[model samples]
Target: MAPKEKDDKPIKINKWEGAAVKNALDDAVKEVLTKKFNYVENFALMDGRLVICGIAVGVAMFALVWDYLYPFPQSRPILIFSVTTYFIMMGILTLYTTYKEKGIFAVCIQKDSSKKENVWEASSYLPKYDDKYNLILALIDGKTRQRRETSIKKSVANYIDVNGSVVNELVEAEVTKMHNSLLSERKEK
Candidate 1:
């Protein structure tokens, strides 16, 4: 016999707990491994550049100031300003790349009802299973590269179904793997 049908009512998804977050990440992963190499590519380049440039600029700024016989402390505003600006510039570059690679990232990060509604609506069609797999995979992918969680959420949101249990299970299996990975990662850190 078939499993009892779950009501069409959208489950109250507490993103902070249980399999919801993991499943979401899994679903995006399915897409990432399949349709979104560009997203990953852009992220890798953007992040790698951000980290490298951030450190380089920070070092150069300190070196430039250190060489100066200025009557200011090392933590003076000017020195701080220079370094801060470099970080800001890096942040903007990251944002631009992120926005270009993954449209409307702001929606997923917001805490408002509208954001939740939109995320759910956008993901309404992608049932528990497939979405679970794709999302879990994507989140894991992002974590490996130091990606923001919301980016994974946005990617997961893009590929959703209303109710596909079997696919959700496949996705769930992957999600479980991601969860295990995450726990181990935390332990390692």
Candidate 2:
């Protein structure tokens, strides 16, 4: 049976029951950690070559529209100024956002002299997030283990205080249960 909270409380939480609570907390923490890693992965995606290309195209279109709608005193000077400014801003944004780059991008070019045809293919540039993902998972596991150990220690101490030497078997059983739970989790992985 779970130990009573005290004279003032109504319900009691035994060691086994406390495991359920800890399991829920563990799941929530794991979800949060996974979500953090997902956010990092999304950030990595945002700095891709495709996004840069899209930004360049968008800025060019905006410049064209601005020039068309409002004619400056000199068309050539205004166009040159806006285009240069846009490219400078794009370069700054790219530097700020894309700090790290991993993996190689391959481009293939094929030319036929007789047919006078050329084909160009480019590989996608995507960041590799496997290391970060694995590190996050390991952190989640470490945090979960730490939380469970502290909770079990507190429960065992309380049980000992309440029942003295008689609760030794219960403590042993609880330890065994914790060991089994960790083993099962490792097996799942």
Candidate 3:
């Protein structure tokens, strides 16, 4: 007897059901926390802002004291220029920070590369309600690394929910149906 060859076809394992879903969701949340809410980056920006503000304050105070002490006519223009430049720089930094943060949140979802046959990619929008996330899950072909299907569940763990929880139910059912439909469509072709 000849040995059987292994199938190279991608397999879809249900990562979005039972306790597994919790783990997947936790991983997604962790990614968001680590990448989007990065403490080090935040601290650095905040420190920069504080330093700029302090410099502005120090300059203003020095100018006030100097003017009161000596009353130089030329000092006012120099003080104004320095203070205005500091404020403008601070504003630019603030705008850049805001744009950077928004960009992070805008593309929060990332691909999952743990498996070789089928991959589960997950993303979420900013929580609209306290402790509730709007999650989007995609099933990707590991070989092609392309998204085959997607499922959106809004307000996970919502009070008086319509969409239902992310765990132990919704995603698996939806994905399975999609998988079956795809299989059937392929067979027909």
Candidate 4:
């Protein structure tokens, strides 16, 4: 008997199924991000930095005006101190914000609505950490909104790891549950 050739054809899925899969993958990624990595999408740090900058600017302006009006040696020192304080605060804010932003790990799975392609485009932004596997995964959708979720188990396993191992068991379970629920919903409709 002749050896059977493996089929290399891609599976054809409708737009509805593709959307469902994309949604499930997105949800799974969000779960992994929040549960395993403990990443929350909050602007508290940025807001705090802005508030501090405002205070520094106000102090510097007050010192400058005081020195201009009083013209005293003591007031000059206060002006210098306020100006120096503002610069130092700005430098610290820049450095800390850059460090924190670079440390964030992110992943995105988007469907190209412009094109009629069925493939869901996936991309990941992993932080450069000392450990290769210690990464935080965040899934962003087409709208560019940062959705806090878990990692994609099978759909994005290759993107996360080269060994094809499941990223997280919890993520895998969640993905399976979502997929099953989606399928059941489709059957009921």
TM-score of 4: 0.34
Model 3 weakest lDDT span, ten residues long? 101-110
Tens-place lDDT digits, model 4, residues 62-131: 9878988888776878878888888888887778657754433233233345532211112233223211
lDDT of each: 0.41, 0.38, 0.46, 0.46
Using TM-score, rank the candidates from best to worst: 4, 3, 1, 2
Better of 1 and 3 by TM-score: 3
Task: Find the 10 residues in a row with the least total lDDT in model 4.
Answer: 115-124
RMSD (CA, Å), each prediction: 17.0, 21.8, 14.5, 15.6
Error of 4 at 58 (Å): 1.9
Q: Which digits, one per residue and each the tens of the lDDT, describe model 1 over residues 1-189?
A: 877665333333444333665444434443433332222222343465567577758766775766485646754766666667777777766776565434221112112323221111012122454433223122322233343222123333332343422234344344445545644654566
Q: Which residue runs does candidate 2 get wrong by more than 4 Å?
A: 1-55, 70-73, 93-98, 102-189
Alpha-carbon error at 88 in model 1, in Å? 4.1
- State which candidate has the highest TM-score: 4
- Model 4 residue 7 CA deviation (Å) reads 44
Worst 10 residues of 1 by lDDT: 115-124
Which lDDT tens digits does candidate 3 get at residues 25-67?
5443433434443311124434555676787677678778877
Residue 149 lDDT (model 2): 17
Question: How well does candidate 2 match the true structure in TM-score terms?
Answer: 0.26
Candidate 3 local Cα displacement, residue 33, angstroms = 5.6
